[model samples]
Target: MSVSEIEKYGKINNMYKVFLDIDESSESNVKPMLTNIASKWLELPNGFLASNTMDGDEIYIPNLHMINLVIGN
Candidate 1:
């Protein structure tokens, strides 16, 4: 992972390192999926930090839309 200096502005100013390890077959597709997720409206019913799976290759997102996208639903 490359270290990036924190920028003073933007929604992600507080950096969170997320490691994604989808299947090799899906690896190349993950970025696009993530891009779509970023563009879509997301839900934070459990708050931002509580939204994701903390330790799995599958990303934890509070929004059902993103979760379904990641899980190939």
Candidate 2:
């Protein structure tokens, strides 16, 4: 599904919005990855909500390359 489709789903379900911070060169895998995530959301222990840090505290470490799934209403 397209990003707008995902956004519309989120709006209807009050679920989430996906934000990608990836370079153009890495665009090839974006759609499949998003589809996988959307399909697996309910299987996640924490459901749709998430955070960048485990304890809700900022990580002071610099230059960290991480993929965070933060679902917001």
Candidate 3:
């Protein structure tokens, strides 16, 4: 899903979860791959929401107060 869509409706109990499912034997490559994926997501439009992984998937969710505070000013 696009970052915006994910941000709009991609949370469980107010947190985003991402998972990296590489084999435990391939642990060395996981960090760099995840970092690249994160960078690509950051390049998406309206992609400022914090992102993280759980169990091998990436999740994105809105930052409510941050958005409100920015908009309120």
Candidate 4:
């Protein structure tokens, strides 16, 4: 989802989750990669959330791509 789309649904009590589609990345490697992305982007919905591992997928915190935000990725 784009920044404008996030601004609309990203609420104070809620959040959006951005997941990196990287299969080769280890848990340790993902942290830096995600940080790099965040550093380049200044403004966020509710600011940066947290990096998390869900069902084996590494996801960056403070989401940018939410399913409900847009129709498709």
Candidate 4 lDDT, 1-73, residue by residue in tens: 1233323235544654444333443544544545544433222353333223323333343454323211224
How many clashing pairs in candidate 1? 0
Off by over 4 Å in 3: 1-20, 40-73
* CA lDDT of each prediction against the hidden true structure: 0.38, 0.39, 0.33, 0.36
TM-score of every candidate: 0.26, 0.26, 0.27, 0.24
Judged by lDDT, which candidate is best? 2
Highest TM-score scorer: 3
Name the runs in model 1 displaced over 4 angstroms.
1-14, 39-73
Ranking of all candidate structures by their lDDT, best first: 2, 1, 4, 3
The all-Cα superposition gives candidate 4 an RMSD in Å to the true structure of 11.9
In candidate 3, where is summed lDDT lowest over 10 consecutive residues? 64-73
- Give the range of the ten consecutive residues with the poorest summed lDDT in model 1: 64-73
Q: Model 2, range 27-51, lDDT digits (tens) per residue?
A: 6665456444332222244223222
